[model samples]
Target: MDSQRRQLHLFFLPYLAQGHMIPAIDMAKLFASKGLKISIVTTPLHASLLSKTIEKGKTLGFKLDVLIIEFPCVQVGLPNGFESYHMATSPDLRQKFLKATTILEHPLGELLQEHRPDCLVASVMFPWATVVARKFGIPRLIFHATSFFSICTSECLRLYEPHKNISSDSEPFIIPNFPNEIKLTRKQLPELFTQKVNDAGLMELYKQVIEAELTSYGAIFNSFYELEPAYADYYKRVLGRKAWHIGPVSLCNKENEDKARRGKEASIHGHECLKWLNSKEPNSVVYVCFGSMANFNDSQLMEIAMGLEASQQQFIWVVKREKNGGGKEEWLPEGFEKRVEGNGLIIRGWAPQVLILDHEAVGGFVTHCGWNSTLEGVAAGVPMVTWPVSAEQFYNEKLVTQVLRIGVGVGAQQWVRFLGDSIRREAIEKGLLRIMVGEEAEEMRSRARELGKMGNRAIEEGGSSYSDLNALIDNLRSHSFAVEE
Candidate 1:
């Protein structure tokens, strides 16, 4: 069985986004650690971003490698190095970026044909991978970078069309047949759900993604069973699909350097960030970050700055750098930096998120509720102030604030492409105050800490995530053996 495991090879194709790429890399390393030969297929720029992690994996004797394909930047009329959604600054460029991903279908197929891996685990974004996998008789597993609850909610929305009867965008509609009495406003839904099919081909692409998941062998989620057991069970039993929950995948990074350099280099030095954190009292500082793809206009940024200032809590805020902007930020309140110099540290780019969250001094997280950040906070035992901006983030926010009861929402009721509506300073201030102090905050922290312990347990030997991973590998190996027979 050990030799058979050594013989099996798997190919992972992650969508070219930070949220998607980071988890896929971690999952690949997990597979490699289990003695499976793993190859991650991505474009050059994305590959370069993950180079350090892959080298570290090699040093640890994991059979991990990367396969790079040239992105069709020239043909798609996108600038060179514009390989990720983070770089797609305009609506026009966003369309071109989506076009570029479809163009890579051919090169990806070539890689699959040459390598003939035992299985292909591709992101849901690349629906065309289903057909490519079928051509070679390879079993493809669709990788969803969100929670089972989000996937279940999305599937229900597609099947039931529950929001159609809502009187207005702001009116709440209950999702029918869900395990929980989940109510969502029409405004919080993704554009694909609310907009016309003919608007921008979004519906067409969404249909393809759904069909790919249906046709694929099974699905993979970056969640553990204890986190969403009911939804995990419902997805397979009720939806009639094969799935596995083998995550909190970020836990695969056990070293400080690995955690610090997980996705990209930290904008601030690790030591400097640590030094600032060390100066604060335990559970006194709130760490604020909005993940990789969410962007806000100047007004929104100003509101966030004012909100943090008004909260009067110590904090470390990670602000995304503008792609094309230069010099001082015009949106900052007059003398804001000078006023909050010692009380706050505003990092202007990527911050070592896992490092900060795991620190004893950091008690609460002000997060965008991207699944990675959500689970990282859970794993770190910190409660959150949920501010979901786009994608399935609103659904995740409900899971945090409603189901898990470990977070407070910042009252963001709308979803937009890039520049979302500004949540007022008062709302942000209120959310920070709720999650960072008092009896309610302590109760939330206690619940979050227990869940964090469960997350840690789930990844250990004989734990749920550990057992599920072994089951997935055994299932794949059995399929390989059957083919050989």
Candidate 2:
């Protein structure tokens, strides 16, 4: 049995985005640590991002390797480095990037044929993985970088279509047949659920993704069972799909260096950030950052800056660089940096987010509610000011604010594709105040700390996530043996 487990090889295919890739890498590391040979298949550009982490994994004696396939950037008429969705600044470029991923099917299929692993764990974006897995007689597990509650909600919305009767976008409708009485307005729903005339290409892609999930062996979530036990059971029993929860995968990175470099090289030095955090009183700082893909106009950025100032809380704000590479400082209130020099740290690009959040000084997170960010906050045991920007972020916000009760929403009511709605500084200030100060804030912090402790326990020996991971591996090994026989 030990020999068979050692012989098992699992391949992970993550989508070309930071949110997807980071968790996938962590999952791969987890599998490798358990004596399974793990291979991560991705494009050159994406592979480059994981090089450091892979080297570290190898140093720790984990049998981890990366298999790179050429991205069809030239064929799709994109620039050399425009391999990931984060690089696509416009709708046209993003569409072209999606096209390029579709083109990767041939190369990806070839790699799978050459090095057939026992199973394939693929990002939900690549629906073609289902067909490829079938061709090779390998089980494919769909990976969703989200909470069980969100997926359950999505599935419920699909089956019930409860929003169909809403006369106005602002009028809220309850999602039918859910464990929790969740309400969402049409404006907050994804375009797929709301748009009368959806983009034909996008609609088709979504259909493929859904079909892929339905036909795949099962689904893998980067969540802990204890965090959403009801939703986890509901997904498997009600939805009738095989599922596994082996995460808060970020906790796999136990070292400061690993945490700092989890996704990309931090723009600011880790030590410098730590030093700044060390100067602050415990549970006094709010860590503010939108995930890699969120784009805000200058006006919106100005509102955020002002909001942080008005809240009068110590904060570390990570500002994404402008794509065009000019006018970066135009949005700041005059003398804002000078006024808040000691009170705030404005990181121009990527900050060591995991490192920052894990600090005792980081009392609250002002976040876009991206799943990776959401889970990281949960793992860090920090309460949040939820400011969802797009995609399934609104769903995640509900999980934090409504289901978990560890976060406060900033009243962001609309879901645009890329550009965020211009929320006023007042609303932002209010949200921060609710999460960072007062009696309610203390209560929320206590809950967050408990959840964080649960997350840590889930990844430990004999914990829920640990058991799930072992079960998943054993299940795959059994399947492999059956196939051989």
Candidate 3:
């Protein structure tokens, strides 16, 4: 905690998903450590998902309070009840969700009026939350749930029409006027902004995003300075917003203080996943998991299984039975599981991803290129074998490969919107072999370690991210409605 900074009464509202909610919860804990009271506004379901963690967090004086919000999936047949992510694919759902939540605005305003917290923090994807903040004159700090690269891509698209048709395989093309590592073929942009997505609800949602981008006074990013200094500097120098990169939100949790930062080779439990890594050789085992939302097609799943076995390396893979509403299972290439079962541990549904990444046995991450996964891997100093699924993952993949040299993307071309065209099985095997077991793999692993150490250093006393967060809170205090404007 920075003593010179004034304490805040913070209200955080995530975009209503596991990935979004987890980080918001972590930030609440961090604010508590600074002796601030935090009110987290989310739906009943989301609150239930985090109940156990909140129970454990009480030791630090953090409070997790739930607020009711409408979920359309319960009324309509959209997947998982969250409208924002699924909105790109469903305009009817988006409009329906917007209407439902619009009814929530006044009740929310009344809640805030009653509580009168000093500041409001929201995920950038949801602008309705921002409206509530504006109504109350509360300072709004939008935390992007993605890399600087994705935000840059969105901003560029909002300005220039020429960079609108680029593809993933196309050569480097500049993002109009921006002086960051932002380049894209129209295809390399998120599928939402692609010309291919014109028929979907993406165009409408993109408009909402542009509006939010123009409005926020402050921003929070989940990256360390060493990982993206140029972009961080660009935001500070050019964007003129109060930006804070205080993250790897996992570190703010009580896990590190439990005296059980898992060492190598313990009987693996949820809390002990990293402990098993302690027993493995350096750069040996591969960590295989996607962000909670990013999973593969049935055919792609088979290819990955073959690839993992063919790499001939140890692996810990999280295999969820179904993804979204894509229910049921894909039959494995017969007997492959039996062959590698002794050398692997397959966790289904959910795994303690951050805890596993912090382990010694984990040498490399096979990620779907979600911004959270990408940043978490970076914070852990784990080099990646990039295989993006969708949303801003393509942007994240570009950041991992081009901006940071610690990872390799397997596909010759990415940013695809179709299902039938997936990467080949042999290609998956070869990519893993190169990134996990070969000499180049060892080199990448060392780079990842160096990067991870730098990220950790940035959060210690007097670290860049630490100082920046303190500054952000100070600015939040100054802008409080209870004080002045």
List the candidate 3 regions with Cα displacement exceeding 4 Å: 1-7, 70-103, 165-172, 176-183, 198-201, 254-268, 271-279, 322-329, 412-421, 481-485
Cα lDDT tens digits, model 1, 329-436, are 777888888899999998988999998999999999998889999999999999999999889999999999999999999988888766766799999999999998
Error of model 3, residue 166, in angstroms: 6.2
lDDT to native, each model: 0.90, 0.91, 0.68
Top model number, TM-score:
2
Which lDDT value does model 3 have at 408? 90
Rank all candidate structures by their lDDT, best first, as comma-separated numbers. Answer: 2, 1, 3
Greater-TM-score candidate between 2 and 3: 2
| Candidates arranged by TM-score, highest first | 2, 1, 3
The window of 10 residues in a row where model 2 has the poorest summed lDDT is 321-330
- Candidate 2, residues 67-143: lDDT per residue as tens digits? 99888888989978777888887667877888888887888788888998999999999999999899999999999
Worst 10 residues of 3 by lDDT: 258-267
In model 2, how large is the Cα lDDT of residue 271?
97
TM-score of 2: 0.97
Worst-scoring 10-residue span by lDDT in model 1:
195-204
lDDT of 3 by residue, 1-485 (tens): 34345556788877755556666777777777777777777666666665555566676566555566655455455556464442433446555565554455566687789888877888776666677888887877887877665666665566675464445436567776665545666546555555565444446655775677567667888877778777777666766555788876666644643312211112236645655666678667788887665546778778888888887889888765533354335636676667986577676656667777777667788888877778778877788988876667777777787777788977835565333237787887877787776678778878888888887888788887788777777667666633552
